[model samples]
Target: MAYLGVDIGTSSSKGVLVDASGTVIATAVRAHTVSRPRPGHVEMDPEVWWREFRDITRELLSGHLGGPDAKGGAGPASGASGGSSPTGVGVGRPGPVAAVGISGMGPCVALADGASRPLRPAVLYGVDTRAVAQIARLDAELGRPAVLDRCGSVLSTQAVGPKVAWVAEHEPEVFAAARRLFMPSSFLVHRLTGAYVLDHHAASQSVPFYDTGAEDWYRPWVDAVWPHMELPELRWPGDRAGTVTAKAAAATGLAPGTPVLTGTVDAWAEAVSVGATRPGDLMLMYGTTMFLIATVTRQLRVPELWSTVGAYSGTRSLAGGMATSGAVTEWLRGLFGAADRAVLLAEAEQSGVGARGLAMLPYFAGERTPIADPDARGVIAGLTLEHTRGDLYRAALEATAHGVRHNVEAMRRAGAAIERVVAVGGGTRGGLWTRIVSDVTGLPQDIPTVTVGAAYGAARLAAAHLEGEAATAAWNPVRDRCVPDPAAGAAYDGLHRLYRELYPATRDTVHALARLRREAAGTEDAASGGAPS
Candidate 1:
């Protein structure tokens, strides 16, 4: 039998189908973009998620994922003979779809009416800094220390509580009708099985809304900020939410009663994809934003890091994220005429250490960790007329590497035991970025055999739901390792110092410029939140 996994990402939605032997049957992607309605506001129509999911499911169903014809066709990869699983779900044969797993970029604010109708476009994660005012207000009202002590994370742009409050304060109409909240995975779960549930990991990011110690919604705090809204029921990322409803089955070609797992944020799911769940294990996700998740036994609340429940039950995580990483390189690529990425990677490698004496700050979309400054802006320093596009690209990559190191240092300071580092995501594909990160941070990274990312992890979760977790543990193994170069690292040591200094030096100037730009654009308002301390 086959399992299907789908992930809704910032830029696209991807679906993957795999068989019992952990072989990929087929994959599909639907590219899309988020809407920037106003400065500091990032959103997407929630309908797009379901639409792309439906389209991707149709495409994957028509691919290598096959069953039997009259018994319901099989894809070309269906080699296993007919059989049944312990759940009697028809694992090896009859059921074309053993289980379905869903994940997506989160913790987001997707509010819906009582009937599951979206009230407005979904407010995205940290990149959407529109909730700054709400963050500050809530922190002052609720006491920042109490929040950190109970929530395991400070209220920042990443927290879901503030965004919900932002709605209640700014868009009262939307709040008046808001009854259900969701991230992409839970949103899909609601669509597929009519279940109002969210993974504990995602809920924890709701910050102050969920109490880490209690492992449940902190009812008093949640009610204080977001009164009268029905939250999704909590479950582990891999726990079974429900089965496919007949209505959903007809819409997506999934058989009626196909099991569905409660999925999680893309980064955690991506961590599962590469088997980075043990204590001291770090999963570095390189994508539009650079995310770092460190699996830990202790739940420490560091002001600079996000502490949350792990994707699996009885597990905990300390995480950090950069506002942008590959995004900076992609931005540079566009300015340089969108050069072929492979060719650019080659050129960047030739640019060598220090990017020809250039240093940069990867704050194109503000920042999330170590320095949680929404007012922080990108800075390119020590540039010259002679600098080439490749040099600029190299500086961008080095800048992100510095950010990773900064976060790693904070994680270490917080007493997180980070022993193993595994790299995953599209950014890991080019090799140059991963090597640069390794060289700059002095951390050797294990490259897994399968790096299809969160969608693959979602598939892995689906497989684990059927065959048990251990089977999926060995499903993806390290194929290569990116070891740090002492010599190159020594050179980056200086550049990283310069990188760190450049931010503070430029902060005041950038903050003023940012406000001026907003004023000029006529979008600056009281609700347009300011920088966080």
Candidate 2:
């Protein structure tokens, strides 16, 4: 039998079909972009996710069945299969789908009406910093010390509590009509199985709304924030959410009674993709943003970092994220008019460790974890006319490396035993970024065979639910490791010290600039005769 796994990401939606033996049989992707109507407001219509999921599933199934006409055009189970296709026409039959799994970028806020229809574009996680005022107000009202003790995290742009508060205060009409909250994963589950459920791991990230100690929604806090809204029933990441309904089966071409597993956020799913869930294991995901998840034996609280429930039950994690990582690289590529990544990567490699006396702060989208400064702006120091795009690109890589080091130190300080670092995502395709991170942090990184990321992880979770533990391990394995160089590590030690000091030195000035930009945006919106876009 085969399993289907799909992940709705910030940039694209991907689907993978894997067999019982843990081999990928078919894969498909649909690229999409987010809406940046105003600065610091990243969002996307929920309708886009469903459309892409339908498209990717059809493409993957068509590839597996040899053509769209196979099995009387019922479609090849889409994201549900593994290994090479069996040698025969009967292999295209529709009954091979054993289980379905899904995941998405989350801790997002998608307020829905009673019928589960989205009221507005989903406000994305952490990267959307429009809730700064709400974060401060919530922290003050809830008591910072109490929030840290109960919720396991401080109120920042990352928290769902403040985002909900922002909606209630700013858009009272929409807030009044909202009845249910959904993230990408839960939204998909609701559509497919007619079940309104959320995974515990995702719930933990909804700071002040969920109590990590109790492993359930903190009702008192929920009442204080959004009293009228009803919460989804909580389930573990691997638990079965519900069976697919006939209506959903007709839309997606899957069997009507197929089981669908409740899934968690993309980072945790990425961690599961490479078996990085053990105690002391850390998963460093390099994508649009840089995310670190360090699996720990117990829940440890640090204001600088996020402490949350792990993908599995009875485990904990200390997580940190940079607002931007590969995004900075992409920005440079656009500015330099380069069509491919190889050109930029090759140039950065030749520019060497120091980037020819250039230093950069990768805060182009403000800062997350360890700093939590939503007003922070990107800064480039020590630039001269002699410096080329190569030097600037190298400095950007180094800056992200320094940010990783800063997060690692914070995790260690909070008692997370980071024994092994597993690196995954599109950024790991080129060796330079991984090597730079290792040299800077003095840590070794293990690269897995399948870096397809969260989609693959969702498949694994599906396999585990149907065939048990053995099915998960056979799917992905560590293929290589990047070890630290002693000399390069020494050089980075001094540079990291400077990186730490640079932020504080320029904070006040950067904050002033951020205020000015917001003022200008407000005026423009007022002139346009609407709210801040």
Deviation in Å, model 2, residue 482 alpha carbon: 0.5
Tell me how far the alpha carbon of residue 531 in candidate 2 is from the true structure, in angstroms, after superposition: 22
Clash totals, every prediction: 7, 4
Give the per-residue lDDT of model 1 (tens digit) for 100-190. Answer: 9999999899999999999999999999987787888898999999899999999998999988998998899989899889889998999
RMSD from true fold, candidate 1: 5.6
Best by lDDT: 1
Q: Show model 2 residue runs off by greater than 4 Å.
A: 66-95, 523-533
Against the true structure, whose TM-score is highest? 1
Which window of 10 residues has the lowest lDDT sum in candidate 1? 80-89
Please identify model 1 stretches exceeding 4 Å from their true place: 66-95, 526-529
RMSD over all Cα atoms, model 2: 4.8
